[model samples]
Target chain A: MPKQVDHEERRAAIVSALWKLAGERGLDRVSLRDTAREAGMSLGQLQHYFATRDDMLVFAMDFISKRTTERVTARVLALDERTPEAILRMCVAEMLPLDDRKRQGSRMSISFYVEALDNERLLSHAREGSRKLLDFFEQQLREAQDRDEIPADRDPRREGMIIMSVVDGLTSYCHLGLHTAEEALAMAMRHLDTLFGAAHETKR
Target chain B: MPKQVDHEERRAAIVSALWKLAGERGLDRVSLRDTAREAGMSLGQLQHYFATRDDMLVFAMDFISKRTTERVTARVLALDERTPEAILRMCVAEMLPLDDRKRQGSRMSISFYVEALDNERLLSHAREGSRKLLDFFEQQLREAQDRDEIPADRDPRREGMIIMSVVDGLTSYCHLGLHTAEEALAMAMRHLDTLFGAAHETKR
Candidate 1:
């Protein structure tokens, strides 16, 4: 048998190219032709795979959502002990625009988020992705409370919400350019340390 | 003396129209002719208000920045007391998107921020607006600490940064319909109370 190309890998390649195209031009400006060209395929071939622009967009968004979740689980699975620090390190790493792929992914996510402002179906996809991120943070908060890393009296959900908000906030700041990707990540890590380390245990 | 139409008021009216149009269709999609038409003026009249499309974009962006600052300051100044709870209440209220005008204004600001990514002059203006907002939070953090609203040991800069981040993240959620604006606001407010209440000396 001749060597076989993987269908899943090929689909991912298309999504990868689509993400790059959307990042350079805003999502509204990216077209099937542009993505096909970027992916080194004909329009016919691209359409054969995606069938429609909405299909392509959904695939691309889900592709990103899956990859991100994979990275976080991989990090957690590798941790020796899931301390607040260990969990936070992994979770915060997921938020950083650490490299070109992640940066483009972030830009695409941002544009999609704005577009979702006008489209509920799209917003549902966005919301699921958001819930996953927040869930991971809340789980960590609960784990920390169990381990007595934080005070038992402190509400995990409320604390988790604060951490999640800051993560989301710093992510936008990187795109908005209040800080570089590296700078924002570092600043956030510092901020997280304060809340999780000293302050949480102290009662009012 | 014959009443002269204040250039300032006319300029504000023109910018207001642009902001409204941006909310309706986004910044990139809004055109000079359409904006002028929406503002109930001819192209020549709009030109007298702003000479070119580029001028209008720059002015519109600058107007957004100034208005946001003014809104924050207006609320802060009007507050009768500088108590930590009072200040937190005032600042958080200004930061939230509880009404249509504030929501539209914020959406318009984000639109300008995206446009500013490619435009250097507008980038500085946008950055300055962001920095000023962060500074406002920082000042509030300091004030809160002095008044025993928050822990004195907490780093004001980092706390401010995180709070700003939380505010931005909630706005992203609101924009994407992840949560109702009121629900998101309530969630955020509850967490913020924990953050402040934990650090303070007051016991309930």
Candidate 2:
């Protein structure tokens, strides 16, 4: 059991190194040899954990997605005001690159997304993640509707997708420096205002 | 003058070949040599048109941007109903990957976007294009407001940015097949409905 725990720790360390390199240079530029060097390990040792570069890439992507979900869940649980509006805001905010850690994560994710466009395996994985996120968004919107927080006529599924797109679009622009993180957040809040009605504005 | 025209044509041909390869494989996987082969030319011949790979990339990006603009312009010009709402609809529609040719273009553009994130020169070029597009969107919203098409209090600049983000987000999902092109179009139209008021829905 102790040996297995050490093995997991080493893999985690290697994935961390991969993210660091991927963040600095785009993911496409990352090589197993370079990642080995970044992780302060021999190439053979790194290969022991990940048989192929694709394996490493897949593992790294999976790791990031899980970590992001855990972080968002923890944040949501700690919120004093857990209204549907508050939950939706927190979820969207978590999606954006508001801080240094998130910015790096965003960069790596975008890089992975581009790579996935051409790779079927990666693309399928991405689609699965997207579906789950979309479902979660829809659930939140449905809850808001139940509480009469939003209009009865609103289609929760479509509205969830639109919110997803908005956050994604804002995140991309934020990375390019076309819009500041604060500006993106304001735009998202305004969108929520339109959805939940301006009269129910949540206090900061 | 004839020699200059031939030179320009050769460069255009190379860019076309690059796009074909980029559409098949991601842009990161494209190489000058492979592009030359794809163009049915020697590497030497290709090098005569482009001094370096970066030079070729910049030229290809610039060419795509100009071509897309020309296509969108031609499309809008052909519109019989030239209201601000109609124009906005057309513009957003053009951004979507509703067909094969556009799917290819979107794939290339996205690949270039990921590459640009790590390349300073490419990022600056991308930023310039984004700024211009955002400005155009703002101008359209302002025109809509002037005609009393949308609410008077709507901030054109912010609305423009939001619209930009929505379109971008939808485009990305369309490529990933998370949303069908038609569904994406409907979502965008719904967004327009909110902005222009449902009563003012333009007759298709």
Question: Which predicted model would earn the best DockQ?
Answer: 2
* DockQ of all candidate complexes: 0.64, 0.80
Docking class of 2: high
iRMS, candidate 2, in Å: value is 0.9
Q: Provide i-RMS per model in Å.
A: 1.9, 0.9
Model 2 ranges off by over 4 Å: A1-5, A198-204, B1-5, B42-44, B198-204
Measured against the true structure, the TM-scores of the candidates, in listed sequence, are: 0.88, 0.92
Q: Model 2 over residues A58-176: C-alpha lDDT tens digits?
A: 89889999999999899999999998889999998988888888888888888888878778788888888899999999998999999888877678988899899899999988878
Best by lDDT: 2
lDDT of 1 by residue, A1-204 (tens): 999978788899898787777767788778888899998989998998888777888788887788887888888888998677687877787767878778777667778877777676777887887776677677888887777666666677656666767776787777767888787787777766655665455532
TM-score of chain B of 2: 0.91
